[model samples]
Target: MPKALSEHETEAFRERICDCAARLYVEEGPAAVTMRRIATDLGCGTMTPYRYYPNKESIMTAVRTRGMHRFSQVLEDALGSPGDGRTRSRAVRDAYIAFARANTATYRLMFEYPEPHKDDTAYREAHERMLRTVVAHVDVMIDEGRIQADAPIFGHQIWAALHGAVMLEIAGMLPPGFDAASLHTRTVTALIDSARPPAP
Candidate 1:
């Protein structure tokens, strides 16, 4: 009989499976992620991954949920930094790109892949928390007279612009000689400039 794994070993093995699945999904897209493939990548029995995750979708959900939680932490750290509105905004923007660059595959999968199950509370709550963080930051800016727009609407607008730039960079669609960091800085600055209250 196979030796039983200790609880810590079981949890570590589960994380390894999820990490491998996440990388596969990011590198080869959703169709390439499978329970058997994950088990093979981890050098385990074909049934090992299935014992932890019922199917490929469950593994995907776990990956996505973990991504969301990490993302929320990034945003939270940015929001908590000591700074004025523009400073905080810049920190958030930088953090956003840093996360994407550091975890390219997982970041892409988080935004591009659809959840296999709609009822995954962990994924839903984690995603919602990230948005709420953005909204809270927007509220702070508005209170400081830094932003002149609806908090949620403006926050999502900023997110869209940042996401678009990051996606283009990831897809290699940006023009040759384009400096992504500079472009991102200019894009963010322009948006902030446009949102400022007009002078009397």
Candidate 2:
């Protein structure tokens, strides 16, 4: 018979499953992650994960949410790091690139990998928060007269440029023999510089 879990233990087990899912998802994409696999890793019954996550998508959402939360924290830490707004912005970009490189799977899920869902409240919110952070950075630049203020979502435009470069590099869409790391930095610098086009 399976051992019954107390209320505290049940909650702890649920959290454990979530944590394990995140770790596994980071190590491997969602395609390779399954309830049975998680249960095997947890040494629990195959049905145990169902008790916590109704489906694989549920686990994917939870793992994706967890990764976004971590991303937000990384942005916060990078923004607060040494130097002025420009320097701090670069730090945030560096943190973002480092995080992607370190957690390739999470980065894939965040940008390259895609998920299907009807109601993606958490995912939407996390994406919005990420854009807001970018907008805030551009706001700083605008205050310093680095970028024009008239353009809407000027910051997100910068973000889109960054995402495009990073995604291309990760998706192996870069030039036949281009330096990804240097190209990534160059693209970011150029985007920020371009966002400051002369006012009409």
The TM-scores, one per candidate, come to: 0.88, 0.72
- The local distance difference test score of each candidate is 0.81, 0.71
Residue-level lDDT tens digits of model 1 in 1-200: 98999999987887787779889877887778888888888898899787788888787888788878888799789978998977887787778889998888778878886776657788889878877875667777889998698889988888887888888998888778764566677776787788999897
> What lDDT is reached at residue 123 by model 2?
75
Worst 10 residues of 1 by lDDT: 177-186
Q: What is the lDDT of residue 27 in candidate 2?
A: 71
Residue 118's C-alpha lDDT in candidate 1? Answer: 55
- lDDT by residue (tens digit), candidate 2, 41-138: 99988997998779877877766666677777787788888777788777777777777766666666666556675268987777667656655666
- Model 2 stretches astray by more than 4 angstroms: 1-31, 42-44, 118-120, 149-152, 168-181, 197-200
